[model samples]
Target: METDSDVELAVRPAPHPWLVLREHAHLVPMISLGGALGALGRWGLAQAMPHPAGAWAWATLWTNLGGAFLLGLLMSCVLTVWAHTRYVRPLLGVGVLGGFTTFSTAELDTRGLVAAGHPGEALAYVATSVALGLVAIMLGLGLGSALLRRGRPRRVTP
Candidate 1:
């Protein structure tokens, strides 16, 4: 014997995949544009400050740190000031910042340093990058939030 719950479940039709895709179709272009702009910025930075193999990847380190900072700031804005702005997070946080930060390149650089008999430098690079990245993100979040607070109008007490 079929229960009422079973009957209800059977009566409800599943949503079509195309409809789901169409709902989020607008986000694709925003992400794409942000990613392209970020990639170009990163490429320009790398070109300006080229680093050879087995050396400290200053460019990658700075790029990742900058991205992390920006992501934190963007998140603060998104959660507070831009809460209703649907595309802001996808465009800036996921696309632009994602493209700007290169984890693979950082790993490759670390490996190259290790292979080149500079294990100490590799360890230092990795440690400093991770530590600094964390600090940078925290700083970004704090600064963004503080700036937002300052900009907000305070209510006067009677």
Candidate 2:
């Protein structure tokens, strides 16, 4: 025999397609606006800071590291203190940070460094970027989580 839980599940109506779309309708605009601004900032940085010959692309490296850190912090804040806010995660984490970080440009920079007779620099850049990016994320995560915990209400046990 079906239990009450089973009966309740069976009687519940599935959400309509229109309702699903409406639920996520805000994502498009939020992501779009954040992405546009993020991309524009990246482009402006690239233009303003030209890469030196036979060396690392400091701009891209900085961008990726900063973006990764921001994403980690954003996620921590959203999942903890700002959990009640719906759109902050999508707009900042997915839209802005996603657009700000450029894997394609990073790869191109590495390749160009190698092609420009700087294989050592290319390897160093790649290694440093990956290593530092990981560290940035970890640092951001730790700091954000600490701040979140500090701001939260603590329970007093008897």
Best by lDDT: 1
RMSD of 1: 4.8
Per-residue alpha-carbon lDDT of model 1 for 30-75, expressed as tens digits? 8898898888888988998899889998999999999989988988
lDDT of 2 by residue, 36-143 (tens): 888987888888878876567888998999988888788788887779987888788878888888878888999989999989888898898899999989888888
What TM-score would you give candidate 1 relative to the actual structure? 0.84
TM agreement with the true structure for every prediction: 0.84, 0.77
Best by TM-score: 1
List candidate 1 stretches off by more than 4 Å: 1-23
Instruction: List clashing residue pairs in candidate 2.
Output: none
The pairs that clash in candidate 1 are none
Q: How well does model 2 score by local distance difference test?
A: 0.86
